[model samples]
Target: MLRVTDQTMTLAAQRALGARQARLAAAQATASSGTRITRPSDDPVGTGEALRVRARLAAGAQYQRNIDDGTAWLNTLDSALGSATGLLRQVRDAAIQGGNGSLNQDGRNALATQIDSLRRDLLATANTQYMGRSVFAGTSDAASAFTDGTPPTFNGTQGGTVQRRIGPDQTVRVDADGGAAFGTGPGSVFAVLDSIAADLRSGADPTSRLTALDAGMSAVAAARSDVGGRLSELARAGQATADAATSLEARRSGIEDMDLGKAVLDLQLQQTAYQAALAVTAKVLQPSLTDFLR
Candidate 1:
């Protein structure tokens, strides 16, 4: 036969009541918040995975922003190049007109002045700035890229490229060295323009010097093409990074978020079981003194 004591019965009833209250509170919290896991310990592995995915998404978003900033900087330089190319063409035309014997000394002088003005414009273009920093200054953003004194100095450092990470393990370099775009030594755009200006002032034959001007023109066009290609590459990389970030965010949501429907159902079942346990425990705890004495 099984034996029961008053002390044991009271303890059992108290445990059952405490369990029922805990279940009720859990059910209320789930119903109000619609979440199964409120803390890290609720699902440690899932939470960790979610955090990792979120971090990747944030990194990708920042990479896209970097690409935008880089593109804007490059576009500013490209616009200046366009203006320089147009001025060079004008100077070439003036030189051709001045070369003709039909034009007098005064006309030649006027052409020389125009060439000087165009040279100044080209120099201005080379010194173009973006947000107080010279775009063509290479790694020297604080100094002027071009100075008009003497042989015309480029006060910046050597050509440098910048890289941005746009994916989990992928990075893209989106900058071109100023020297690569503008050339070095005698083949540089500035050097050619200087030669043309000097020749125009000294009464050189425009028809003979026309070949040099054409080469300079080609170099400018090539630089423009190079910038365009880089722009396209940046655009493609930015789009890919954005897509990747979106995918990661969705994956994170799946891992971190709770299924409201399933959580609610489970809470309801737990509440019912807890209430039944409380009722049975209360009945078992109620005992008569006469029954105990017998």
Candidate 2:
């Protein structure tokens, strides 16, 4: 009976040691990884939640990048439009000077040259390139937005719009068609400029050309207003995107990022428990309880 009791006691001690070792390994792993849920088996529900938040965080980051790229494109376009506006004003001034009847033929010709140069400058602005892509062109990056020098042409296929993700399942188109921004109908701004140049060459009255120049200026102003409206829209959407990204990051932090305070406390608790377990184990594995009792 004494031998049987000793064997039973030894078996119980071994089982207790095995359980303590398993717990110690688990605690060490948790501390080393700094995560309670290293795998699905560790904490299935927590891991699932983390995976979902991680996916959203990834998507939000991509959307932020898209918003940045879209805004950059719009900024380049705004700069080009500003330059074009200045060129138009120069053309208008030259046209006014040409209309002065007091000026001699040589003076009129000089004004005509200025107008032509200004027209070319305007064309260059329209064809402004950003990152090897024409800012005014809808989508085709390889070709210039305007083809004809005397008169501009939209080399792009049709009205194109660029989409930017501003929020969850929300996207906004942030560009206007080149045709609408410039002109399209017969006797359009380009046609009028072409006529102005022809009349100056033929030594005809500059009055009609001057009137057309004023009208073209008005058209340009209208287009600029349109662009300004779109820019405002993009500005609003960009702000919303930024706000959403901030919110998502906050959510991800709440879901995944470890709390240093909680982690530190947990680690200390695990260490204390492990130390206690080791002390008890040493006592149980000792040669004989009588040796200590004595």
Candidate 3:
């Protein structure tokens, strides 16, 4: 048999009121925070999913940064190669003029001087830098890819590559092969230009030099082609990363963001329920002789 008393009723009402207050507080927190989850305990599985999404977002941000840097490096390299090719074309023109047998000594000397000037310009292009790092240096920390001399020597590394990780499983080479583009040692294009200029000054035909100049131009064109391909690849990767970021952001929002209309309605409902509980408690826990005696 169970007996109902004032003391038991008071205790029961206190517990009921505490429970209502807790529900009200939870609703207020959800409304104020504007999130579906005010605490991890509210939805442990959802918290884990949100955390995983955020981690992926952080990694994607880093990948985006890598893509930007790699693009800059490749663009600079492409521009340098383009300039090198144009200079080679101009030198080829001057070589053709110097090879004209009917042209006199003075004309050859003038053409030789122009070729020499073009050689210096080509050298400068080979040593192109971006953010103080040589694009053709091949991972070498040297200030320039080639040193200035009668036959400029390749100061950059051979076979070494500079690369950037654009994704967890993807990497792109950013630096160029300086030695391949511009032949190293005496076989270099700089030396070839010097030979042409020397032959021009001595009244010898430089038509033979044109073949080697064409080879140099071909090498630069090949390097540029490779760069263009990678740039295109990076462009695709960047777009994909951006799209993934958008989708992931939406997913994260769905997991963490509250629906304002629904949240407000829930909060209002909790407030009304708590008020009703308070009124019911007040009515049931009426002051009695026992409370007065105590």
Candidate 4:
């Protein structure tokens, strides 16, 4: 005859009940959180991949921010260059009018005054600041790129290029070299304008001033073109970064996120299983004197 002991029955009931409770708890958690792998142990490989993807997403976000800042800096430079070009064109017109020999000393003096004003305006444009930093000042933190002097000396260095990382392996220069755009020392655009103003004030011929004015105009135009190109590059980089971020997020969601409907169904099944196990354990563990009688 086979012997059925209370100890064996109690051990089997405890094991079955413990397993059922554990599964029920897990299902409830999954349903509430709406995630299949709440802990790394649930899916170690997926967790590792999710970590790496999250890191890349964070880096891409930072790159996008850098691109935005670079774009703003380039826009500021473009505006300053446009303003400088307009001033130079006005100076060219004034030079043309002053070159006429029919104009008297008073007429020449009036043109000189207008040129001086325009020169100051151009100087201001060269020292244009964006977000409290000079746009043409390279990496220098100076309030202005040029000093308020006779020739408007360049206080900022051209060797330092303000660059921004827009991608994993890409960086773009956001600042213009003031020395290249406006020249430096006696050959600077400010110096050229000052000299023209002095000549006009002294009743000198305006025909000689046209050459310098044209050269300055050419330099400003080139700088504006460079800024435009960088703005376009930043736009493309921003779009690519955004697309990459979206892809990474989708990949991460696949690994981390869970289906709410499936989780709820699983929870319901686990609850029913747990209740059935409890009822079976209650019946099996009930004392039956038949074993002792045997």
Candidate 5:
């Protein structure tokens, strides 16, 4: 049988009261701070989960920013190509009119001058830039996609790709192919227009030049289509990233955030329990003779 001594009773009461005090303090801290886990010991697993969710949220935010930049780049490409398309179409129309026998040499020369002006406009369009970076330069650091000369040479990298990471595994090209869009070197739209203008001034048939003009138009249209497709992809990626961020935020809140109603109820319950415990300990550990002498 165990000894029924006052010393043993005192120790038991102290241990019980200490435990009650700890519970009351923990509940008060939770209620005041509005957090479920005050320290790692309170909930280690939940802390780890919250950290992972936060990391995911950060990554999603970055992806969204990339999507935005990519969208802008693609839009710039589309606008430049649209302008080029309009200019090329105008040249095509003028060339058709100039090819007729009824048109006089002076009239043809006038049309040639108009085409030369449009060729300069097209050259400017080919060098379109976004954020000081050439949209048709294919990741190159060149100031312009094409050089300013009699026959503009493409300064852009042929195979280099300007990529934007829109997701953990997804990337999209945001630059246009300069060579494919406006033709590089001698076959360039600028050079082709120069040839047509020369023939018009000499009173020779301008009919042969229309084929090259149509090819230039086709190239610009194709580049614009590609840019539009990339913009659509970026739009979808942005939406997906936003949704993922939202979901991760919710998950993080679930793990770290407290329910005020439940916290308050728990605090009240602990307060009641601790007070009752103090009363019990007081009665059980009544003062001994030594206490009266002091």
Candidate 6:
């Protein structure tokens, strides 16, 4: 049996008061902060889980940013490809007009001048930039994908598709292959346009020029189709990323957020217990003969 003495009683009351005060402080902190498990010691397992969830949320946000940037890059490519297709169509029309045997030399010269203007426009479209980077340069730091020369040589790297990571293990190509879309060296669309312009100026037969124009048009159309498909895939991936972020945030909230109603109730109960303990301690530790003697 524990011996009952003034020292023992005083010690017991102090311990009781300390425990009640600790409980009250904890409840007050939970209510004020609006979060449970303020410290790792409060709920070690829950804290770990919350930390993991927060990391996942951060990753999801980064993926979302990547998706947005990728979408912009793809959209720019699509617009440029569309413009290229339109320019090719204009060149095809001019080729057909110039093929007419009845057209005079001056008429062919006018058609050649128009085609030259369209060729310059096509070159500009190929060199489209986004945020200071060439869209078709394939990771090259060059300002333009093609040099403006007789046969417009490709200055960008080949087969170096730019990519963006949209998930932990998934990456999506964000740039088009400039070589495949615009050809290289003498086979390039710009070269073909220059050749047609020269033939028109020299009054050469338009049959072969028409054939080359059709082939260039077909290539541009094919590239546009490929970019459209990639846009669709990126849209789907973006939606999935948004859903994942939402789910992750919900999970993190569950682990870290406190229930205000429950916390307030608990705080009131702890306050009452602490007040009661303080009143009882005061009565129990009143000045006695032993304390006075000590």
Candidate-wise lDDT, in order:
0.73, 0.68, 0.92, 0.89, 0.87, 0.87
What's the TM-score of each model vs. the native? 0.79, 0.84, 0.92, 0.92, 0.84, 0.93
Point out where model 2 deviates above 4 Å: 1-11, 21-34, 288-294
lDDT of 4 by residue, 22-115 (tens): 9999999888887778899999999999999999999999998999999999999998999999999999888888887878989999999999
What candidate 3 gets wrong by more than 4 Å, as runs, is: 284-294
Clashes of each: 0, 0, 0, 0, 0, 0
Model 4, C-alpha of 258: deviation from truth (Å): 1.1
Compose the digit string of candidate 6's lDDT tens values, residues 161-259: 789998999998888877788888888888888887887889986658677677877887888888889888889988998898889888888889998
Instruction: Tell me how far candidate 1 lies from the true structure as C-alpha RMSD in angstroms.
Output: 3.8
> What value of lDDT does candidate 4 attain over all alpha carbons?
0.89
TM-score of 1: 0.79
Score candidate 2 by TM-score against the native.
Answer: 0.84
- Model 4 residue 87 distance off true place after TM-score fit, in angstroms: 1.3
* lDDT (C-alpha) at residue 286 in model 3: 75
lDDT of 2 at 90: 73
Q: Pick the candidate with the highest lDDT.
A: 3
1-294 per-residue lDDT for model 1 (tens digits): 889877888888788778877877877776778655567887898878777887888788788888888788768867977887798788778867877777776777777777777778877787888778777766675566767754567666774655556555766554445555555567666666666566666777656667767877777778778778877877888888878877897787677656788778878888888878878776667667875676
Candidates 1 and 3, the one with greater TM-score: 3
